[model samples]
Target: MTTSPSLLAAQDLHVAFPGRHGAASARAVDGVELDIGAGEIVALVGESGCGKTTLARALLGLVPPTRGRVVFRGEPLTYSSRALKAYRRRVQLILQDPTGSLNPRHTVYDAVAEGLRIHGYGGDERAAVAEALSRAGLRPPERFLLRYPHELSGGQRQRVVIAGALVLEPELLVADEPVASLDASVRGEILALLLRLRADLGLSALVVTHDLGLAWNIADRVAVMYLGRIVETGAVEQVLTAPRHPYTQALLSVLPEAPGDPVVLTGEPPDPSRIPSGCRFHARCQILAGGEAERVGVADACRSEDPEVLGGGGEAQVACHWARAGITA
Candidate 1:
């Protein structure tokens, strides 16, 4: 929670996709509101199919929101091609897989220089590529310039992908599972690189990941998403140490602890097309299932009325009927 105004924000954002047999479009994302301020790192944490990645895409305008708007620097995003391109140049996306993101045929120099070409850089492209590669930790940039994707190691390949994004000198990065495919040792390197980039360049980032540990490692704030909507948001220490929402508590319980039984959740997350009414997580919530919700007199509301994000804002916000009643397990 930086006191500075938000650099990027989602205002009641929603994203839906067409369903089978011309059925009603399934809402993959439903009314997600988030904010990332200058020089701040925000992690969007959740399970698979939780719409964290889609929300990242929507923020970058790679996928248009079905409703609401994305605001950058306090202005609504424009839909025009030119405006969108400019916006994209300011906000870059870092994909999950380094192997899939890099082109096997293109040399590292050409790959890093691609963005410069697309945006019609008038200066020396080679110098820009070299600087980008250097900044991305590929020291002695010339050593990597001639190498193809196949010639590089996995860590090197990811660096190249990051270098590609860095070449544009973007203000904000929407990184979706940026280190998921790397080796355990290499994961730390990438995370450190991201932190360094943020510190050195004043870059803000929205990282989408399932690893709560990663969120704790780098993010200033963490937003926990379940079935598209954010159920809890707070400073990393606050959310991870004292989670208010049932879903957040359950998620944290699974993290490898010293001596506690992990909260094993039953059943898979609900399908997007058949999303549950009211609180989407009610069906899988252990607290609600164990009669605690009834004791708190929120059982009815948990099953019928949608719980909105509440918690007096700033560094701690939760969207749960039971949580509003101070009933977090």
Candidate 2:
């Protein structure tokens, strides 16, 4: 979508965990297809337990998919320790909690330099760490070099974690709710920092988030996940501002800035281990439950047929019986 080379992609991916006593496996990531273009930012958004984080793990090769493959720069991941080790150098992760990610005993320099050491970087470690720190917005990197995680504020700790990832010169970053732990003021700063990093470093990213508002602020494109599958995807403006899927519409409607009163969804998402028959979302779909799909003559289909999996292309796509039929009522 950014007219850049495709950097990272997942094709028909699935990651499932076996249940106790041979129960149905928990399909944490099921039949997902997504792509992040070079220098492009794509947000993977969904509520907790919908498998967004699991998908990120699979993409980073932290969790091997039960099926399908992850393609980086056009090559499928081999999952061999040697290949994965090399692959990690080009793709890094930034976790949600900086305090948890950084060792309290280790100074900022050691923390940021850890990746370089692990990767066996041959260049000047100090210079690389300094540049990474500076790039993460910690000015005068020397000032923070010796400071431990306990000495820094929440925002500074986050920058240090970012610096750690940057030290590897990674081409892609899989950031899971990178700003969810920051204060309101600091949140904007971190988001801006990510944007700046993208512009300056030509970095690509698959940002995992539950906040649609954050996606609107920082992403070039969006993939909305539900029940371990992508229900909708497109350019950010198209997907976030004008969502087409009923699940996506419900997600967006609950945002504080949305014009209408929030559409309160009924019941928790069905367990991943036993996903519903037909449309996985049909039992709780507001549109179908509200009689719109029935009026449009697709409610029966919604209850008996699974929608097609999204192809992860640039074109806006929604996996909905009524939507695909152009019969929104």
Candidate 3:
């Protein structure tokens, strides 16, 4: 049967934190919107401190948004006791740091079974734990069951964290930089594991990461965030191979390439606290000059006013005015 379009949706979501009283509040997520469908993997990517983690937290209901809503299975989410409980059951988050997230004191069994116990999966806890561990590729369930987080290797510990989330049988999984702490070789293994889980269990995932290479390898779609806003989003091929936003282009320009083609960025990304007026990217954008009346469709209002996400050629949605003006062409 054809599944529904989306299992989780974040609509015009805005999240902010306290800043200097007179100054603008620290906006971590600015009017962010996206959807994750059943069995689809969406990668949220950007430079560090671009609000990927904040968006992930908002989706999980760990923190309330300043504006907009998050809907799960077509139902609006709330922080009410009943709503929170139900939400927790259906949506789970796998943190980046396996060692930090897991309890050093608890055995692998206890760590993986904690979710089950919390949700009252009393009778089936053992079976669920075994199944979860096995699913995560932690074989010899009996052997792993008694091991502590300290006893397991980095990769194994990460698998245990995944198993812990899987035991709950959540429909949507939010993995925030799950492999960030691992070695380069171990990172590939973890990525493979996640891909396998998606194929086998038919789980929908939202992976938040700063690595464009990782996103390119596993994501069906990619969303590029900057200064807490999604500057571009579309199928992986569309956004990564041929990006429209200047910011997106700047990001891709810095990626490591083949021996002949060297990657370089002209300038550094702008600071979020002191975001430039109009286009947040104008400060560092190579397309726009210092004072040339912003260049018609390319600059114009784009440099003076924030542009909303607009559907560009193909299935991509870009927030740059120049994208339509053939700047990306």
Candidate 4:
């Protein structure tokens, strides 16, 4: 199969914020290189505090990168007011918490119409709102137009949040745990909705999620993040079923269907301000725990040299000393 042209690319992106009380700044996103192709859904998966959300914000132009740049449709994304306004219209952010994202005071119609008003949509605002609502699965849009956030169920509230983004007619969407706040039953519905939208609208999405299952359900590609960097990235089946990186292997080992005992990783991720010298995951790596790296003869490199994400976006790529050489246990 052929690869589509990338609609958004993050090249060596890094985002840092000042630490508590004059301490050194903490790097939330460090050296994240990722690409989201046109009409593709790329899931950014990892545990909490792994920089997935920060990367999403940087992509949306909501947070400026400390170092590196984000490219959109072959152009370097800019933060100028005019440029930002245009970018915001083309790239929408679907927040995790629908209840929190929506204005409690605004009615459903008002919430979805806000983007239209901001973007100067002069043509039939009412029809635009109705269409957006319908696209988001809130059918008979007029029936929900007068409802408020508290009046709707959790699932319906999230749909309104989606309708708000859909109203902008964005070509790309950055959804941060879009279904995390919904019920299990609603989760499948939301995921199905995303798949349908992708097929129907040719919309591209960068979804930040902690659920591996979600990636399996909807993402065309999966990029596994750890501590601020992608440890592995590839087609969803490739990365999830045959992960090359030790971290990826350990992560997949814990899946419910994974046979035998889980390979539990020890040690917490290093502080971003004090990330280790070489492999960021070496300290907690299962493969390197009991002299396995020595057996593989890659201990020296794993301890002293940082490995860049290898492979030029082929079917799969991993950033690890052993992974590149097929040395995982």
Candidate 5:
């Protein structure tokens, strides 16, 4: 909630993919500014193709930003192989699909020890792996050491994946859809495990998910992304319980068992390469569609002005013409 980034941050970040065959470049992450405080969990929520995953990859230094920069511990992230190699040890990635993340041939012990071996960890490998597995909720860690990926259940495999990251003893975990592949029950278990890990290890996390309910339950703050930018961000309760942006409101409106009829905005988000001139969301905005912006005398601004979100921590903020006009649909 502070004004500065205490851990990892993306400042004016932009990652673009040059199109081929005379096509325009696709700006996957156009201009993102986000921060994660030490030991705090922040959820990046958006629909598919919203650049959430691209942003995560940039934060991990896997993909270098074309325009902006990533910062860690108040220092700008360096992309050199030597710097990245060292950086990866302190920041680990937890992939979405546990089944594909693990090597079927690798034993649990081998999978967990791979990082230690890669980093040339001189300490006791067995003890470290055991401790990591134990911390990841695999009790009596020795019991699963020799088991193969095929031998373990879905939940257990995910725990192994989490153990792989924990083995490195990272300060931050960037998890991309950590529970999306599991069943409802397993999802709850995984969420609970993440919370437990945070409490036990003082670890910070950046969780990329489309589920606002998951964010509401697990994250201290929620950042709502659309297209390639964050449109709203603040404390989870403040944003989820009372979303200010039209996009965030539409996202929450479609949740299961949520009150009122869903706000069905027609058409998908604009292409990243051909982002509109005005508000990128104006084409599909419910407020604009319902004439609320016109009645409030901000329709022109909604159609011509692209307001930047208020970021870099502190109080809740939103980037929308109607909201800025002190109006809500």
Candidate 6:
């Protein structure tokens, strides 16, 4: 199969915040690279404070990266007039908390139609609103049009937010922890809705989530991040079932397993600001200093020199010195 053109690309992206106590800034996203093709879903998976949200904001131009480039549809993105307007139309973000994202003052219809109004789609507002609402599974759109966000259930409110994004007819959707705030029962439904939208609309998605289960369930490809850097990335099945990076393996080990399976992680991940030297995971990685060291070939070099992202089988890629040293899932 031929590879589609990337609708969005982020190269060597870095985002930093002013450091406390007058020190240098804390780098939240460090030397990150990502590509979302015309109609592919790439999930950014990691533990909390791994810079997933920071990366998402960078993609939307909501937060500027300290360094690197963000290109959309072959053009460099900027916050200026024409480019900003065009970028806004092509890329939209769906926040985690629907209640907070949606304005309590506006009704559902107004919220969904707001984008159209701002973008000057005056004549087709009604039709567009109805279609967007319908596409988000809010069928019989009239029934919910006049209702407010508080009037809807948690699932319904989230769907309304989806509808608002859909109404813009964006080419790329960056959903940052979209289902994290929903009830467990409703989470599945929202996930199904997003997948369905992808299938029907051929929309590209960048899903930022801490839940590996969610990534496995909906992502076409998975990129695992740790301490602001990508450690592993590959097809969902390959990365989840046979992760190469120690961090990825550790993540999988802790996942709730079937009967008789053991947990993976030995300790908590290190703080981002005070990241470990060389490989950020050297401190917590079992392969680097555990019973598997002989078999895995994790040497002192792995701890002294950071490994570059290397090509793996298929479209997979990993950044670990011992990737080919007999490490397994």
Clashing residue pairs for model 6: 253-264
lDDT of 6 by residue, 1-329 (tens): 11678788888888988888987777888888887888888899999988888888888998888898898888878878777877888788899999999999999999999999888885778889999999999999999999998899999999999999999999888999999999999999999988998889998898999889999999988989888888888889888887888787767777786233544665776766666777777777777677565465567757777777432122788887677564565
| Least well predicted 10-residue stretch by lDDT in candidate 6 | 305-314
Better of 2 and 3 by TM-score: 2
Q: Which numbered prediction scores highest in lDDT against the true structure?
A: 2
lDDT of 1 by residue, 1-329 (tens): 66757899998999999988978777888888888988999999999989998899899998889998999998999889999989989999999899899889999999999999999999999999999999999999999999999999899999999999999999999899999999999999999999999999999999999999999999999999999899999899988988898888888888877136777788999988888888999999888898999998999999998887433124678888898897655
Ranking by lDDT: 2, 5, 1, 4, 6, 3
lDDT of 2 by residue, 1-329 (tens): 45677799999999999999989999999899888888999999999999999999999999999999999989999988899999999999999999999988899999999999988999999999999999999999999999999999999999999999999999999999999999999999999999999999999888999999999999999999999999999999988777888889999998887888888889999999998888999988999988899988899889999998999666788899988878542
Task: Give the clash count for model 2.
Answer: 0
Alpha-carbon lDDT, every model? 0.90, 0.92, 0.83, 0.88, 0.91, 0.83
**Stretches of candidate 1 exceeding 4 Å from the true structure:** 309-314
TM-score comparison, 1 vs 2, better candidate: 2
Model 5 per-residue lDDT at 91: 99
Q: What are the per-residue Cα lDDT tens digits for candidate 3 across 34-78?
A: 888788888999988888999999999998999999988889898
**Per-candidate alpha-carbon RMSD to the true structure:** 1.5, 1.0, 2.9, 1.4, 1.1, 2.2
Worst 10 residues of 3 by lDDT: 258-267
Residue clash pairs of candidate 2: none
Off by over 4 Å in 2: none
Q: Tell me the spans in candidate 6 whose CA falls farther than 4 Å from its real position.
A: 258-268, 294-297, 309-314
> In model 1, how large is the Cα lDDT of residue 308?
77
Of the two candidates 2 and 6, the one with more favorable TM-score, higher being better, is 2
Give residue 21's error in model 3 in angstroms: 4.1
